[model samples]
Target: MTSEVTIRSIQAADTYPLRHAVLWPQESIDYVKLNQDEQGHHYGAFCNGKLVSVISLFIDGNVARFRKFATRPDCQGQGIGSQLLRRVLEEAREKGAQRIWCDARAVNENFYRAFGLEPEGNRFYRGTIPYVRMAKSL
Candidate 1:
């Protein structure tokens, strides 16, 4: 894949395939859809004209939460997700969010920490998968 990545706002529907492929392959496609999708802001990262990463941000009051962050398996470790994350974090700050968080998969806690988000509370599970709430003040 080319190293050139473009990050931009996208419709929530555009995030489903990647969300399903990378985050919930065993679930039905409908399981990947968020009920409040129309109320959130979605973004995608494209490399060489192919979508490679996706994240959704929901801002409420002074808080913002990002969800369903995923990168194509083949595109992992290429920094594309990093760029997309930076974009949404910046977007959150610009939109007046004072704190941003996510229910990050436990295995990726270190990855989120590298971006300055700290784990909060005890670890929890969604189905059989473990997760932790990570957050940072913007």
Candidate 2:
């Protein structure tokens, strides 16, 4: 947190550790991995050269979806997540995505809203966690 955050494309496997650590500490690290990870574009936010946040973006036609976005718990309020998300959004647009979306944790809906993503559809559950679809036109 002492250094500036840098965002860069990373291999999908590079996102696994932080994804497991921040999003589901109780689950196995494999639980945080997506079957289609190799086909997606992954981005990491590094602070002082230490990876602190990760997000995976997938593009299909003109639609882009981002998943497994997790910021290190200790780095949560430092604006690192914001920087990473903004980069992902710009990446999507650069890649010809007309829209972008995510299955956002219901409790963190406000965070997505700040980036112009609006909640859509009803709330749903993944195990015991509540989630909602959020999207925005790029």
Q: Worst ten-residue run, lDDT, model 1?
A: 1-10
For residues 1-138, what per-residue lDDT tens digits would candidate 1 score against the true structure?
Answer: 456899999999999999999999999999999998999999999998999999999999999999999999989998889999999999999999999999999999999999999999999998999999999999
Over 78-113, each residue of candidate 2 has an lDDT whose tens digit, in order, gives: 899999999999999999999999999999999999
* Global lDDT scores for all candidate models: 0.96, 0.96
Clashing pairs in 1: none
